[model samples]
Structures are given as structure tokens and as C-alpha cells.
Target: MMTDGLDGVVAASTILSDVDGAAGRLVIRGRSLDELAGRTSVEEATALLFDGFFDDRPSGGEWRAHLGQARHAVFAEVAALDERLIRHGPLEAVRALVARLADGEDLATALRLVAAPAVFLPSYLRLRAGHAPVAPDASLGHAADVMRMLRGQPASSVEAAALETYLVTVCDHGLNASTFAARVVASTQAGLTSAVLAGLGALKGPLHGGAPGPVLTMLNDIGEAGDARAWLEAALARGERLMGFGHRIYRVRDPRADALKRALATLGVEAGRLAQAEQVEAAALAVLKDHKPGRRLETNVEFYTAVLLDALGFPADSLTCVFAMGRSVGWLAHAREQATSGRLIRPQSRYVGPAS
Candidate 1:
């Protein structure tokens, strides 16, 4: 028998992070996702993932300094991509520019690969929007600097914290589609940049990193609390798959969804709209329950991800690009881990055709 999508298959062992779908828990480096959300900076969480994993891993203040230096190092590469910016969205443009970086599984190469998006994504977005790119602040933390570059102004405490929470929450998960792609490329002795390119390619697909923007679109379509039930019912009647309602894993509520919802609540913007989102969520949940009683279709991260990022003033198109900024660290860590395995990730396929 074959597992069609490799569901429930254990392909590799990683010390990076674990996804306990049955329990609705995510743990990174043995720390629970809830504990790290608002309490830790993205740099700190990156360091946690890197500790004891990389040979030349820098920790504490030094890690932040190293990442800062890496951001500055990629500045020229980001600028060079300006002419080609019109050809791709921010995510694709950043992927192409990052592929041009030096290749290797070494510590310096990994740091630069991880920093590429943090440095390049905002530049790509700003340039595409007909604005001059803002330079990265070598002194500020990763999340704050991303916001700074995007808006060309310093982020307030709340804005910085919200982005940091998002970055930290999404940093890594167990053998996700993109992470698996990165590992496969790394297993072939490819450089970190090549592996990361593979990961980004996978993430570009709708099944993985594509749903967040649509949740906002769905909310915009609903418009009012009173219309939410009827709107959802009409959509369901037409056999439309509701966005942000279900997950492949997570029998219970998605912990990441809950985490992001709390982050949006903390930011305290668009009170009326937030209430509308709540109403829509409840209506959608009820509809899903009545329509499909056997399946547990609860809200996933994309719901409030839409709310929080929209509230932060990001255009819907750039949402996935921002996701790449956070997930880059996880990809690098997984790439480095796969490099140490020394075995190519080759799985045999069963032949079904008749023998000649």
C-alpha cells in the first residue's frame, strides 16, 4: 500500500521543531510556541534553533550582530535586483536575488542566506511600489528593521512586537512541505542557497503558503456581521471551500491561529472590523459544522494572519513575502541539519507498468 501524499510517514528526524497535531501544540527547540510568542524576539528564537545544531553558531548579542552584518552584506545584491523587480512579486524577486548569493553550507553562508529576505523583501516591495528602498538598520532588531524598511519609519513598540511574534511563531514547524523541499535539496549536497530556493519554490504553491491573503478577501466580501452567515451559506451552497477554516493536521484548533489572534487583539486596531471578523469566524465555523459533521474544520493561522498583517498596513499581495522573511531562518536551520546527514534523500517508487 502507498501513502498518496506521504501522510503519517516519518522521513527524517529533526531537532528543529515538532508539530503535535493531535495535541494542537508546536514546540521549537523544546520550548512551547505559546511561551515564545510575545516573550522572545525573532533573533533570540533563531539562536535557540541554531544552538547546539551549527558548528559556528553565535548566540545572544553576537548572533544579532552577525545577522545584522549579514543584512548589510546583502544590500548591494538587493539594489542590483531593482531593474528586474517588475518581473516578479516580492517573494519571487527575493528568491531570485537570494539564489545569486554565494553557495555553501558553511556558517557565513547560512547567516547570509537567512538574512537575505530580511534585507531583500522590503526593498523588493518598496521598489515595486515606486518607492525608494530603505536601508536596513544594523542596530535595530530583525522585526523592527523589517517594519522600518517597509514604511521607511521606525515601528512603534506594538508594531515591532506584533511582527516579532509573527516571525517567531512561524520560524519552523516539523517537516512542512517547504522544509521537506529544502531538506531534499540539501541532501544532494547542494548549497544552502540552492536548498532555500527549493523551499521558496514549494512555498510559492497555494497548498502551503498561499491562503493568508484570501482570508482577507473573504472578510472583505462578507463586509458586515449580519451578512456573514448568509454570505458563508451562499458560498457553501455553491461548493466553495471556505478559506482559513480547516487544516490537514490539527484535530483541535490550530495553536498558531490562536497565537496570531492574540497578537491582533493586542494591537487593538479597527475595533469594528475585528468584531466583524469574530462574527464571520463564528458563522463560518457553524456552517462548516453543519455541512460536514465528521470533519473538524477549525480556524487555522491564516484567519487572523489576514487580520494582523492587514492591520499592519501591508498590501495583500505582500503577505506571503512577509511569511518568507520569517520562515527563512527555519529553512536555513533545516538545510544545515540535512547537510550533516551525509545520505541523499532518495525514496524508491513502486513500478506499476507491465514488464516488457
Candidate 2:
């Protein structure tokens, strides 16, 4: 039997990460989400994901240096940026720049693909805002440097820690749509850049990485905590799906949502906004329960992702690009794994049309 959208299909085996939807748990390597997220730097998490994937895999410290160097290397491509690319959104602009990288399966190539978003995004954002782009500081950690480049100033300890938590939380989670896309391309022995580009293409879909921005839009529409229930009820009555309340896999609350909420708490978001968000979350949960009593609908990552990234001063439009910065490492790791150990991914499709 053919499964639509390949639901319940086992596409490839991986040692990378697992998403236990029933348990609301995410495990990367051997570590749980809580164990790795706020406790590890982006470099350390990247090292964990990269372990055993490459013959020349760098240690955590070495990965930090290589990631910094990769960022500097990717920064060189910023000179090629122009109004044409910047006219598109940040994700597209970054994807265009990443397309310029030479395709390869080597560790250096993987590192550059991983670093591309962190380098290209701030450059694209700054250029779009009519400011000069900031150069990468190879001495700083990956998450800290990304924040510094985006703001053209150093991020505080709390701000950098928040970003690191966000990055690590999203770094990898089983064979997600984007990770699967990356793996499919890699199974073709397409280089890491091509695999990552495939992942970016998949992630650009609204059903995937694009939901966080709309969550912000929903929050803005609700305006105040007191207004959340009525506005959400009306929207649901009109057949509008709430942006952040449900997940495809997770029957319980998403663990990443809590991870991001904890990260948001550290940023000292304004009292009114946080209170409004908390109230809206409670309201959304209640409304979802009343509207769809049989279905289990709960807060997912996008809800707090919108709140946290907004608190960090990132533009709503660039949130997906920020997501890419973390997930790129996972994509590269998945790509390397597929290229090294897996066969080509060629699935047969049943014909539904009339016979020729």
C-alpha cells in the first residue's frame, strides 16, 4: 500500500536523533533535550551531532575553531550580495548565497554549509536595511558571533545563552521533513551543499519552518491577553487553524516548546508581553480543547519560538533563517551520514492517471 506523504514509512535508518512524539521527548545522540539544550554551546552540540559522521570530525574545541573559520570563509560570499537577492526574503537571499558554495562531501564543505546561514543572514539583513555587513569574529563562539553580527555589537551573556539554547534545542530531531530532504539528496551522493539546499527548499514550506512568523502575527492580532479567547474562537469558527497549537507527531506537549519557553524566560522579556503570551497560551490550550475535544492539541515549538526570537530583537521575517543557523548543522550531519553509508534514495510512485 502506498502511504500518502510517506506517513509511517521508514525511509532511512539513522543514529543521529530520535523524536518520541508520544513521550514528547527529543534525543540527540544519547542525550535528552534538557540534557543538551541549555547546557551545551552550539559548537559542543555540533560536535555531538558530528561525531562518527566524518573521518576527520573535529573535537568540540576544534569544531569551534573550524566553525569560526567556516563563518569567516562564508563571509567572503557576502561581497556578492546585491539588491536582486536582498529583494527577496532573508531565507531566499541566504539560499542564493549558499548555492554559490562548491559541492562536496568533505568535513570542510559540511562546515561551510553549516556556517552559511549564520554568515549570510546577518549580511543580508544588514544590507537590506541599507547598512554595511559586519564581518565574522573567528575568536567568538558560533551562537555568540551570530548574535554579534546581527546586532553589529556583542550580545550579552544572557542573550547569547538564550540563542545557544535555541540553537541546541533545534539542532536535530530524527528524520524531519527537511532532514529527510537533506538525506534524500545525500543518498544521491550530491554534495553537502546540494543536500542542505534541498533541506532549505523543504523548510521553506509554510507547514514546516515558516509557522513561527505567523504565530507572531496571531499574537499581534490577539493584541492583549484579555482578547485572546474571543479572537481565537472566532478564527476557529471561521475554519482558521491556529498557528502554534498543534503538531503532526507530538500527541503530548512538544518538549521543544518548553525548552524555548525556558530560554525566553532568561531574556527578561517585558512583563506585559510575557504575561500576554502566558495568558494567550492558556487561552489557546483551552479553546483547542473545547473546539476539538477528541484531538490532543497543545503548545509546540513555534509558539515560544515566536516569543523568544521576538524578545531577542530578531525581525519576525528572519526567524526561519535564524532557525536555519541551528538546523544546518543537523542537515550537514544527516547528509554526511547518508552519503557515507546509505544507498541512493529512489522511490517508485504508483500511476494514478489513465493508461497511455
Candidate 3:
């Protein structure tokens, strides 16, 4: 028997992370999402995730220093960012710059691949907006430095911590599509940069990393909490799929969504906006249940992701790039894991075409 989208297929065994979709839980390197999201820094989480995967991986304290160095190293490629590349936008522009990186499976290579988006994203965004790119401050933490570079000023401790929560929460999650794509490339011995590029290509798809922007659009269209039900009902009547309300794997509320909602609450975003979003979420869940009685649909990460990142002042267009920055660590770690122990990911497909 064959399955569409290879549903329920077990591709590779990993010691990295596990996604228990049935329970709506995510565990990374033996720690639950809740334990890490609000407490761990991105550098610390990366250190945890990278342990045993790389020879001579940095300790938690050393991880920050190494990541800062990686950011500085990746900044050299920013000179390649010209008008033509800027026109392609942040994601494509960062992709192009990342392509320039030398392919390798070593610790240095991993750091650079992880750092590429942090350095390249802000540089591209700034250059596109007619501002000079800011240099990396190796003394600062990874999330803080990215915010600092993006705004040409330091991010408040609260802002930095909120971004850290997002980064840690999404750092890795089982064999997600992009992580699987990274693993497949790694299995081919294509090196870390190539694997990450593969993952980025996969994530560029709308069905995956592209939904957060649309969530913001939905919120904008609805305008107010009182208007949410009518707006959602009309959209559903027209057969429109509600953005950020469903997931392929999870049958319950996404834990990451709750994590981000908490983070958004701390950001002190416009009281009305957050309240309206909460009302909209409640309204969306109730409406979705009424419309699709047999299906499980609840708010997923993208819903709160839109609100939180928007509150952080990142434009919706650049949201996916921001996601890439958080997820790149997972890609590198998965690529390294595959290269270390896994084989080429060649799956057999049943013939469905008309017989010759």
C-alpha cells in the first residue's frame, strides 16, 4: 500500500527531537518545549541541540562567542548584496548569499550556515530600505544581536528575550518537511550548506513556512473582534481555508502557539490588537468546529507568530526570513546527524501512471 505525501512513513531515526502530534507536544533533546522556550537562550539551545552531533561543539557559555564569530564571518558576504539581489527580497537574497558559502560538515561550517540568515537578513532588509548594514556585535547574544542589527540599535532585554523564546521554541521539531529535506541532502553527502539550502527551498513553499503573513492579513481583514465571526463565516461559506487554524500533524492546539501567545502578552502590544486577536482566535475555533464537525482545527503557531513578530516590528514580507533564522540551527543539526549516521534517503514509489 502507498500513502499520499508519504503519510505515516518513517524515514530516519533521530536523537534530536520528537513531535508527538497526538498529544500536541514537542520535545527537543530530552527537554520539553515549555522548559526551553522561556528559559533558554538560542545559543544555549543550539549548544544542547548540537551536542554529540559535532566534534568539539561549544559549551553553553562558549556557544554565544562562537555564534557571534560566525555572524561576523558571514558578514563578509554582504558586499555581494547589490541592487539586483536586493530586488529579489530578503529570503531570496539571503538564499543567494548562503549559496556562496563553502560546503562542509564541520563545526565551523555549521556555525556559518546558522549565522548566515542572522547576518544576511538584516543586511538585505537595511540595504533595500536605503540604510547601511549594521555590523555584528560578538559580545551580545544571538537573538539580541539580530534585533540590534535590524534596527541599528540595541533591542530591549524584553524584546530580546521574546525573540529568544521564539527561536528556542522553533529550533527543532522532529522530522518536519524542511528538516527532512535537509536530511535527504545530508544523506547524499552534499555538505551542510547544500543541506540547509535544500531546507530553505522547501520552507519557501506556502503550505509550510509561508502561512504567518496570511494570518496577519486575516486579522487585518476582520478588523475587530466583534466582526470576526461574520468575516470567518463568509470566508468559510466561500470555501476559503482559515489561515493558522489547522495543522497537518497536530490534532490539538499547537503548544508553540501558546508559547508565543505568552511572549506576545509580555511585549505589551496594543491592548486592543491583542484582545482582538484573542477574540478572533476564540471565534475562529468555535466557527471552525461548527463548519467542520469531523475535523480537528485549532490555533497553530502562525496565528501568534504573526502577532508577535509584527509587534517586534518585523514586516510580514520578512517573516519567513525570520523563521529561517530560528530554524537554521535545526537544519544544520539534522544535516549533521544524517551525514554522521544515515544513508541516502531513497524511497520507493508505486507506479500510478497508465500501463504502457
Candidate 4:
């Protein structure tokens, strides 16, 4: 009679995390996600996520150096891939690049595999747009190299720092749906590369991290601040969700949204878009609070994820690619951890269909 299984079973014994969706709490490697977002570097966060689990964690500078090396190593491999079928799309190209990393069996090789998409997708965008994608450099920081490969120039110090902050902040949360999927694959004793591919496929879904781009489209459809509330109401009546409004977790405002909003401002975002997002946020918050006074629904990470990526000179389409850069760290840690546990993650399913 285990119809709906009870929640929060002790799935594993790890010092990694606990996400209290009800209390709006997300603790990572011992600190709250709010406490870590934008306050730490990707390398720092990776070290934290892998702490106690791995004996050797690189410093921020060292990790950057290693990823740069990975970038070059992967680029040579991508050259050998079927260029005709490269697909010229972020998810497809990135998936191919991620899958290619399995050729190397070591952890460092595995990291490079995971890091390739962060470097490759941007390059693919440029190539698709008829611009030559620049290669990565080992001397720069992680964010700076990623920007350089995509844009043919290095990111400004402020922009680079902001991007790095984002990568670190999102590197890992608890067992979110995507991370959980990765663990499930890894639990099969599938290699880490196989596990990461599972994560990317899961994240490609709109319900997961893929909604940020459409949030921008939603804002565009409203056209102006004056159109927001009316458009939102109509959309709601039609059973449409205002992108970036509700969250699966977090009853209050998502702590990640504000941190990214701060970064957007620091990066000198366009005023018009920022103003529109602000209006939509204000109108949505007021309406939601009044409509469901006791409910926990609030602005989630997608809200500012839309605004921030938009401000970075990326078209609305680049949201998932950028998100992949940040999320890959979390995927890598979870995949490796699950593989180390040496247990399959099979859950019993309820049989409600026509019983025989």
C-alpha cells in the first residue's frame, strides 16, 4: 500500500547537503546557499562540495589552470567529431562534447570532460553565427576563458568575477531532480561521463533549468510595463505560468535570485530590460501574495537568471548554455559521489494500473 512514498529517506551518508524546501533553506557543504551565492568562486564551491569526499581539491587558480588545459585537450578532440552533425545548437553540441570526455578515465580527465561544454558551446554559437570561435587560454580565470572563447575577447574583470560567482553559487544543491537523475545513472556503475549525460538530458527539459530563456520571451510578449499585469492575468486564466514566478521549492523569494540580481546590476545591465523585469516582479509579487496569502510560492531563480543572462549580451537563447556552465560542477560532484557509493538507486514503483 505504499502509494505515495514518504519523503526524505536517508539516501546516502554524505556531508554534501540538505535542502529544506518547506523552510526555504538550502545548505551546501555546511553553509546556506544564500550565504555562498556570489560570495564564493566556482573553484571554491567545488572544493566545498567535494570536501571530505576527495583528498585533493584544487585552489581557485589551480582549478582554472586545469580547466584551461582541459579546454585545449577537448578542442582537439571536437575537431575530429563529425562537424556536419555538430547540430549548431547549445544542448546538442554540449551533449556531444560531454560524452566525448569519457575517453579519459582519470578524475582530472573527467573534469575536463565536464568542463568542455562550458568552453565548447559558446564557441559553437559563434561558429553558427559565422564568427570564428576563439580558443581558450590557460592564463586567465575560469569565467574569463569561457567568455573569451565565446566572444573572441576576454570578459571585463567585473563581468568575469560576476560569472564566476554564479558558477560557484549554483555548483551544487541537494538532490534536485536533475542531480538525482545523475545519481541514478551513476548508481548503475555507469561511468561518470554516462552519469553527466543523464544530468544534461534531464536539465534540457523546460521544467528543470531550461525555462530561463523563455522568461525573456515572456517579458518580450508583454512589450511594456503597462502590459504586465493584464498580460499575466490573461496568461494565468489560460493556464499559462508567468515564467520565473513559481518554484518547486522555496516558499519565499529564492535566495539565488537576489544574488544574481546584484550581479546583473554590477555588470551594468541595460536599463530598459531591467526596468521591465522589475515591473513584472513587483506586479507578480503583489498579485501572488494577495491571491495566496499563506502559500509559499515566490520568485524563483529563473527570474533573475533571465535578466542576468540577457544583460551579458547573450540572446535569449543562450540561457541554458550559460546555466550548463554553472550546473556542470554540481553534476560532476554528484556523478562521482554516486559512483563511489557502489550501490544501485532503484526505487520500488507502485502498481495502480489494471491489476492482473
Q: Best candidate per lDDT, number?
A: 3
Per-residue lDDT of 346 in model 2: 92
**Candidate 4 C-alpha lDDT tens digits along 249-356:** 666677777877878778664667777788888887876676668876688888888887777766676677778778777777777777776489877877769978
Error of 3 at 91 (Å): 1.1
Q: Native-vs-model 4 lDDT? A: 0.73
Q: Pull out the clashing pairs in model 1.
A: none
| Better by TM-score, candidate 4 or 1 | 1
Cand. 3 TM to true fold: 0.98
What TM-scores do the predictions have? 0.96, 0.98, 0.98, 0.91
lDDT of 1 by residue, 77-111 (tens): 87677566647676778888888898887778887
Worst 10 residues of 3 by lDDT: 264-273
Residue 325 of model 3, lDDT score: 91
Looking at candidate 2, what is the lDDT of residue 167?
Answer: 90
Better of 3 and 4 by lDDT: 3
- Kindly list the per-residue Cα lDDT of model 3 for residues 141-206, writing each as its tens digit: 999999999999999999999988998888998888999999999999989999999989988888
lDDT for position 174 in model 1: 85
Winner by lDDT between candidate 2 and candidate 1: 2
lDDT by residue (1-356, candidate 2, tens digit) is: 89988988999888989999999999898899989879999888888888887788865568789999999999999998998888888899999999999999778888898899999998888888889999999999998998899899999999999999999999997888999999999898878899999999988888999999999999998995448899999999999999988888899999999999888888765556778889899999999999999999999998999998888888999999888989998999899888888999998999999998
Name the lDDT value of residue 74 in candidate 2. 90
User: What's the residue-level lDDT of 294 in candidate 1?
Assistant: 99
